[model samples]
Target: MRVRIKGDVLCTLLLVISLSTLLYSLLRPTAKQDIAPVKNTKRLKNPPRTAASKKYYDSKVTGKVKLLSEDHHADVDSEDVKPTVPPVKTQSPFDFQQYLSSKDHRNFSLLINQPNKCTKPSGESFLLIAVKSIVEDFDRRESVRKTWGKEGLVNGVRVRRVFLLGIPKNKTTVSLWESLMQQESHYYKDILLWDFLDTFFNLTLKEIHFLSWAEMFCNDVKFIFKGDADVFVNVENLIHFLQNQNASEDLFVGDIINHAKPIRSKKSKYYIPETMYGLGIYPAYAGGGGFLMSGVTMTKLAEACKEVELFPIDDVFLGMCLQRINLKPVLHEGFKTFGITRPSAAPHLQTFDPCFYKDLMVVHSLKAAEIWLMWNLLHSQQPPCSQKQRIKKPFHWKKKKTKQAINAVTRLQVN
Candidate 1:
């Protein structure tokens, strides 16, 4: 009986112990159940930016592309595109198209040829006279042909003559010009026509083409006298002048302009735009009215012209060619290419004094009739003047012009 009682008490003790252990386990803290406040790691590759960072990023990147996955992370404008800059354009005052056209098309087709001009021919001419003429200037050409340009022996020396021309630029009369020119060519046998527009600026074409023609045909000519149709040439005086000089050596003589600046006025006939010629002063060049060059000098000019570029002014272009070959063109008092300025001191002097002209080689700006009249008067000689008064002395500034020309040439060479 006492044993049973002790068992019951033990059973009660076991139940109590089991119930206590259960309560203790239910109330105890676990590792997963530990809830406490802590800091976030924030280790993202492209982390969220603050207000200062967002402003800085938007201003710096011009074309920032965001991926679709970044929609949840950051904010930016969809209009964030690259800005473009407009180009700056400058307008030039000069006509570039016309200039390029002239520069590109220099070599023109030949319309008429005087192949036998130097052969058959004055074979080897003592003087090859080339007059710059036009189709409409029939009277002028006739005057030149009758007077100083007469072919054959002059002063016992052979001379040949040719008139350089280009197609008439007047569209209204272009058709009629062809037939008239052909007739003139057949009659005179002295027309050297090229298929270029006969304009003032295109005179450069006449210059280079004539040089090439001279080289091909009149290779043996002793001398060449190039002049305008209006100028009066004393053939006898010219022949006398050439007799003293050797044609084998270089000789170029005319009324040379020294230290001349380009005329920039648009209305002037000799206007030179800054785009055409940028230089301040032009090279020394002979007057286009008349000039004399030796056959050897012509050959040299042809070669030099091939190397140097064509300039608008024919006279200046030739001067550039001479500069290319280091050749010097001498200025002479006998050639009054600018026309005879009546002496301010001697207003009594006649403009057409045959006695005074006897000492001169060339005189410019004479009318067609004046040239004819001068030729007859000089040959017949009715007017009389003292030998001292008739003398064509050099101007006082002649030496000064020569020195300035030399200095200008030196400056060009240095440049």
Candidate 2:
């Protein structure tokens, strides 16, 4: 009976312990169980940040916002920004308005001059050959010097030479051109350079200035032959022509153009606007190609030129000066200032015949080679004009020239 009672007690204690364990497992709070999910939710809502990653995210957001404002946006601080549009330019091919606007800008200084040019170191200059020239026409000037314009005794009379010039129109090679002129002047002593830009319209200035120079200094000079560089002058023929004429008498002679009007076409290089000149007909003027005037007449021209208004066309301006002094210019047939015309009846005849040039005083628009060839042909005693010859055609042979410029400067004594 005692053993049974102890067994019951042990079974009851084991039962009580099992029931308490089951109750504890069923009644515990759920708060501690929800902790893992709460932490995961907080982590998903926000990611970890670094400097590079934050910059990348902000750049993406700003790109979307800036798309609407792109055209209106201008960064004032950025030097790279500039207007791509170019400035408006004039519509006309030539700026005639600007040229007309600056017409009063005349009276330029003499940059280079020859004060002692008329001193007549050789002899009282019986005839003065004044050629209008520009800087790049070195070959033309040399050809003139080598041929008719050579300063020395021609027909036993003193013949002096000079060139009228101005600053080169080509500005790019101005320095080189200027340097060459110094050497040329030192050697030739024939250049008359002025500060005015060398141009067709400014030839009037050259005309007046030369007349002033001659009037001031060349009172003793008997005759003057003024012409273009391109013209081939028969100086001997000219001297022979002057021998019979008196220097004291007024004599201005050339191929005179009777009735001419200013060219109104702006496209033409000789354009003259109505604002510049209003006259319907230009005054009767000698061709600028070549002309001969006595020293006395030249002096009168110098005085008359100062009294008249400046005109763009040099030849016409000279006519105005002549008119101012109540003087008339005569026409000379020997001066072929315009290019030669082949006889209409004899169409086959070549205009380059050497015989034709023998009697002419001045022939305009001949090449340097033609001048040289004609000079040689005439001096060599070629046949008369009536005979047709093989040399009648233009001389198309290789132009004879030295590899370097012929140093004629060395041959002539330094004046």
Candidate 3:
């Protein structure tokens, strides 16, 4: 009976121990449960995420995208993302003078074949007139041919006119124009053709080529009248003037500008940069509109030009050459480069007048019609205006008084 009682006690003790272990296990925290509560707390702290927000968050966490700030992207639609613009390319400054200096002078070639014109000329030819004309200036060339360019005896001296030209720019019209030029040459026999482009800058090349031609062909020619086609040249007066001047005098005469400064404004037609001519002041040069040079002076000037670098401005370049050779251009009042001014008060407003241009060797900026008119008026037997009626101050006279003076003069001359 005692042994049965002890076994019951031990069974009771084993049941109590089992119950205690079960209670301990039920109260203890597990790793999974602790992690689940932490996740729940984190979810509560952050707002409930939409699909886009979730995707964005995932991308942000993975560092897969660079998104604009909330403020920037707020107004922008998701589909309308702004693209970045590429930077612009900057060009280097163009150095025209340097480019000209770098070129080989020996590469220049003559296109036209007028080998015998300058060579076959008689020893009596006193002046070889070279009018620097462009290929496209057919009208101007015609005007010149008919007017001042008509070759004949002037003041008992033989004068020859030759138009210097370069290649045309228009490729399509080249053949047609060339054919016309050939016909013109055949009929007139007065065109000097070179292969280079006829640009304002390349006028120096024309001068150089003409000089070279003169050196080879008409070396014994007494004088060369280098002028433009637009200018109205008083060939009669010019010849007379040349005859009067000492032939031995190294004559280079025209309207000379002594203290002209280089134009710096880029927008100007005469714009010259420091790169082209670094010098502040330009040497005195005859207004390139028209100038006379003795054969000796011409040869020396050509030699001087050969040693100097090519300058774009034809007049300025010639001046530089003259400076190098220690030759100075003689300034003359008869050479009117700025054209003759008309009297403001005169009844008949004319841009040109026979009386005003009677004594002047050159009057620039004359049109085809005006040139024709002047040619006719000048050649007429009766003088248009008398010496007493002629207006003296062409440049500086007051408008009203000058006009009154001109009217009085005109009436007096008529009476």
Residue lDDT tens for model 2, 1-415: 9999999999999999999988877755465456645654564466445454355446532112221133333432222122321333334434566766775565667777777777837467899999999988999999999998999888899988889999888868656888888889888989888888788888998998888888876777999999999888888899999999999999998999887988887556666778878988887789999999999899999989878888778999999998888888888899999989986656766788776787888899999888887777776754465456744553333555674545565456453
Worst 10 residues of 1 by lDDT: 35-44
Stretches > 4 Å off in candidate 1: 1-96, 381-415
Candidate whose lDDT is highest: 1
Query: What 10-residue stretch in candidate 3 is worst by lDDT?
Result: 83-92
Candidate with the larger TM-score of 1 and 3: 1
Tell me the spans in candidate 2 whose CA falls farther than 4 Å from its real position. Answer: 1-106, 381-415
Model 3 bad stretches (over 4 Å): 1-98, 118-121, 173-175, 342-351, 386-415
* CA lDDT of each prediction against the hidden true structure: 0.81, 0.79, 0.77
TM-score, each model?
0.69, 0.69, 0.68
| Candidate 2 positional error at 89, Å | 6.2
Q: Positional deviation of 407 in candidate 3, in angstroms?
A: 29
RMSD of 1: 24.0
